[model samples]
Structures are given as structure tokens and as C-alpha cells.
Target: MRGRDRFALPILRRARRDATLTRPAVSILLPVRDEGRFLGETLASLSAQTYADFEAIVVDDGSRDASAAIAEAHARDDSRFRVVRAQRAGMVAALERGRAEAEGAFIARMDGDDVALPGRLETQLEALESEGLTACGGRIAYFPRRLVGDGGRRYERWINGLVTPEAAALDVFVECPLPHPALVVRADALAAAGGYRDCGWPEDYDLVLGLWRRGARFRNVEEVVLRWREHPDRASRTDPVFAQGAFVSCKVDHLRRSLLVGWESVVVWGAGPVGKAFARELTKHGTAVAGFVDVDPRKIGRRLYGAPVVGVEAAARFACSFALGAVAREEGRQQVRDVAAAQGRREGVDFIAVA
Candidate 1:
């Protein structure tokens, strides 16, 4: 009872907590790396939450500096806040440890380097309630506005413009488009999926795509809830394990394991780079790829690396289980799924996952 068990109890006690301090239930989650520089401001943002009745839980992933001390300081002053230490595991493992200690009905995620807008929690909770969203994220505003370079600005615009929850399921190729550090999710849903599995470095995106496959609902609040901080040393920028190729690998592996399990022949859509790469990867794992599908008439009837590039029409001939969306665009992925459906292929069973 010294660790996770000691913390999970509040979830059971939440309903009976004092009405004076608690509001609608939530657990604010933070997994800190070497974030000593920004912890104070992050805690400031949490302390300002308009929606109360939540615990601020942080896990220090064996930082060599003041990260643990900063978190401990906050915990010392604020009974609602607690800090715990974990092995130098990756972000996903740290998130899992922190979530196990979460005592709220709803889990709200935040990054140690980012600041939440004053109404961030309230707005996300409201959207989660109204949308009946198991997972709800919101718009983001970039901080140190001058620090937002070209690539960061592009990501900001792209993520902020995602209008629908289906956008997550349909167009995940654009990276973890879910508003990082700004979403709130159902605690049970988080636990049901085994919290978060530390796999690829882009654990946030992996979790988002995973939840989509597991049938958890995600909603994007129209209002901005997080002030995303851009820095030269951001984990996505510094970590090679979080690269584009890594993202493609993560999506493909998850689809294969979950939806395409036990299939004799697997069809990969898109004859371009991603599809070809996926075919190469599957070959490494001894999975037989039936063929490739593409809308490119130039590549049609052509053989790339000995695999025939047939039009989408070829899907009817094979007993392939899933027509994986190998395309990069949202519209392109949908078109492939729609064509397969028209040909009597099911969504998850017959085909699944956008590149």
C-alpha cells in the first residue's frame, strides 16, 4: 500500500470528499523530465484552475537535477498536489505511474513545460460533459510567440484546425494531433487500455491513435486550453525515437497486432513511400503482404520490388483481412476505406488505420 495502492484509494473516496474544497471531479496529470526551469509556472497554472476538486499528480522520471525538488516543493505546500519518483523510464512509463496515483474521476493531462490557460480545465471538462467525450482535448496557443519557428507554427495551425473527433481516427499521419498537455480523459478508459504503454517515443500520439482503435471517443474543444511552449530542446525535436519514420512504424505495428492479427494475407494501401516501407517492415517480421493498392495510374500494373501495384480493384480477388490506409492525406485514407466498404470490406475487420 505504499505506492499505487496508496493513491488509487482517493478515486474510491472522491464521491464522499468535502464539498467545500472539491468541485466536479478531475485529476491533473503531469509527467516531468528535466523540467526544473518551468515547473513553477506549470504549478502556477494548475493552482489557477477555475475548476477545483482535482489532484495535481506528477511523476519525476529520475531526473538528475531539481525536477524532483520542484515537484516536491509544490506537494509540500499544496495538499492537493503530490510528487512521486519512478525509474528513469520513458515518458509513457512515467505517465502510467502518475495515472495509477490519480484519484479523480476524470484525468486531465498537462506537460511540465506548458502553461494551461486560466479556464483550460473548466472548458475541457465542460466539453467532455456536453460531448459525452471519454477523451477531450482543446485548442492551443504557442508561448514565447517569437520562439515559434516555421515547423512549430505549422504544427500549431494544423492541430488547432482539427474540427472533429473523427479527425483523430481518420488523419493520424499528421503526428499526435491531439492537443498535448491539454486534454482530459475518463480515468476508467485510461486504466482499461492499461494506462499507457511505453513503446515509441511519441507516446502521446500512440495513445491517441490507440484510443481511437479501442473505441474511446475524443473531442476537441473549440476554445484554446493550453499555451504550448516551443523550445529548441523540446523532446520531439531532440529525440530521434520520435521521428516521422518512428510514427509510421508505431501506427503500422499497432494496426497489425490489434486489427490484422491472424490474417493470412494483408493488403497495404498506397504504393508510395510509406506503403512500400511498411511492406518492407512486415517482411522483416515474416508477415506476408498480399499486394499493394494505389490510385496512381502511373504505378498501376507496375511492379515495385516484385510486389505488383494493382488498382484498388485488386482488393476483391484476395482474402486479405485488412486494407491498411497507407496514404498520407485525410481524404485519401477515407477514400480507401470507403472503396473497401463498397466492395464489402468491414472498417476494423476488413480494413483499418490511416497512415
Candidate 2:
């Protein structure tokens, strides 16, 4: 964490206590990197949004293609559409530029390649204003390759199905609960997180954690707002920007910040991939692990990843944070939680889901 200035802090303070926008004005911010082919469709979706009191700020991130040309064309027709050109190639840097130039009271993040539904702005605004949530993203649908069989398809379905606040708690345990490309957030809250950082993969997940750390609520409207295109050329699908490993690293980085207690040893609750990954990140951050606990008889009483794998019973002897790294399988997690609970480990304060 870094120090914040009065300029940013004051706005955040006001937004925290005063998020009551009956008819909140919005600033639609889009960051583009060679999104020429479908930039028009994206802009058209924004144009069709039911919400009326908003302007578009498109940050052209040094596009080699005609992305800027589309922006110029859109600006020709509507004065509300604005373009900010970034000389560099950093996405976070581009987002920061857009934030600095935004004039909307509420902030909405959209990608230049993704399409927004006609009611996207209205529904997101409605939920944001009514609930006063600092962060909100609607259900996201994957278009074109909607019938594909890759795990990304399952990911899309799982993500789109999870929209409510409660579901976010569960879904975030897997990956980022709110779809990054589909979210609408309060400007003040964004300013509080020092804008967005290129911290790690799943920048959106990192941003969500930063916002949550600042005491902002995370939410999602059940209604689908954005059509996330699953093209091979997309940054998330192609570059290392939002890969699985990056997502894990990002989650652990932020999780260590918020969840790690000072010098307190952590008890990792699995010996599988997720468990080893969490242990590695925890160790990298200099957070000591009391030991690793597992139910697999073969893993028990053996050293895994240079850490002793202890039986579930051994956990009772240590007072430490338990990192539940079980993913997709909740029964084992529930059992681990049950064992921890029986030993008097409290949720949020003692045990945390790290998958």
C-alpha cells in the first residue's frame, strides 16, 4: 500500500458516506488496444444504454490499427464521446489516463472490444445507486464461441450465473467474482484504490481486493450487461495478462495483504496444486506456515513442498490462519472448516478460502 493525497482521499471519504445518487451521472471509460474491427459495435452498445446521463472516455493505448479512427468517427457524431490517447502500452496506465480525464460522477469500465447490452448502463446504475455498492458488475455472456467446449466456456457459464452478493463470496473463491469488463463502479472508490494497478494477472481481481480493503462493497446485478467475446486474440485469452497462474499469483498477493496476520503462522489445508501454490505465495511473502494439513493418507506424515504435511488432528496444536485451497470441491473444504470450527477457529478471522 502507498500513501494517498487529499485530492483522492477526500473524494473517497465523501463517496463512502455519501453514495446516494437518485439519478447518478456516469462516466463510461473504455481502454482499447487495437480494437478497430468491433470498436463501433462497442460504442453502439454504449449509445444504446438506457442510462442517459453519461459520457464516454475512450483511451486509445497506442493502437497500431484504426481504433483511433473509430473513436474520431464516433466523436464526430456525438460530443459526449471523448478519446484520450496514451503514448505507452500499459493497460493500467491507459485506465489511469481515462480516470484523470473523466467527468462522470459514477464510473463505468468497459472494454473497446466488448459489447454492452441496451439496458447494461441502466441496470448497473440502478443496482449501484439503490444499494450504494462501491463496485458492481452484471452477469457476463460469452458471444460467438458461445458453444465452445473449452474450460473457458464453463468459466463463462459459472461467472454469468453468479451475480448476487452472496454468490460473489462463493464465486470469488474460484476466480474474480465480478467480470472485469462488465463492471460499473463509483468514481470516488476508484480514486481511493489509487486508480488501477498492473499488480498481477486478473488485474480486476486485484482491483476488487483493493476496493474491498478500502471498505467498499462488491456486488453484481443478475441481469447480463456485457457480451464478453472469447476471441483468440483477446488479451485475457492470449497474453499472460490474465492467465490462470497470474490469477493465482494476484489473488495470493492481495490475499496475503488482507488475510495474513503479523508473524502468525498459517495452516494450509490441502497438499494439491492450490495448496502448494498458496503455500509458496505465503512463504514468498515471509508468512510462516505452522504446517500443512491434509486428509489424504498418503500425503499425511510426509514432507510436501519442503513443509511437513500433518494430519488434520495436528492442526489443533497450532493457532494460525487456515488457507482453504480446495477448489471446485467444497465437501473437503466444508470438512476442513468443520474440523477448524470444532477446534474453535472462527470464519473470516481465522480461516479463509484461498482457492
Top lDDT hit? 1
What C-alpha lDDT, on a 0 to 100 scale, does residue 293 get in candidate 1? 81
Candidate 2, residues 133-196, lDDT tens digits: the string is 7879888778787445567676767677666666676445567778888888888888878788
Which prediction has the highest TM-score against the true structure? 2
Candidate 1 per-residue C-alpha lDDT over 98-186 given as tens digits, one digit per residue, 9 for 90 to 100: 87777788988998899998778667766676666778888888989898887778677777877577765555544676876887888
For candidate 1, list the clashing residue pairs, or say none: none
Relative to the true structure, candidate 2 reaches a TM of 0.86
**lDDT of all predictions, in order shown?**
0.75, 0.74
RMSD of each: 6.2, 7.2
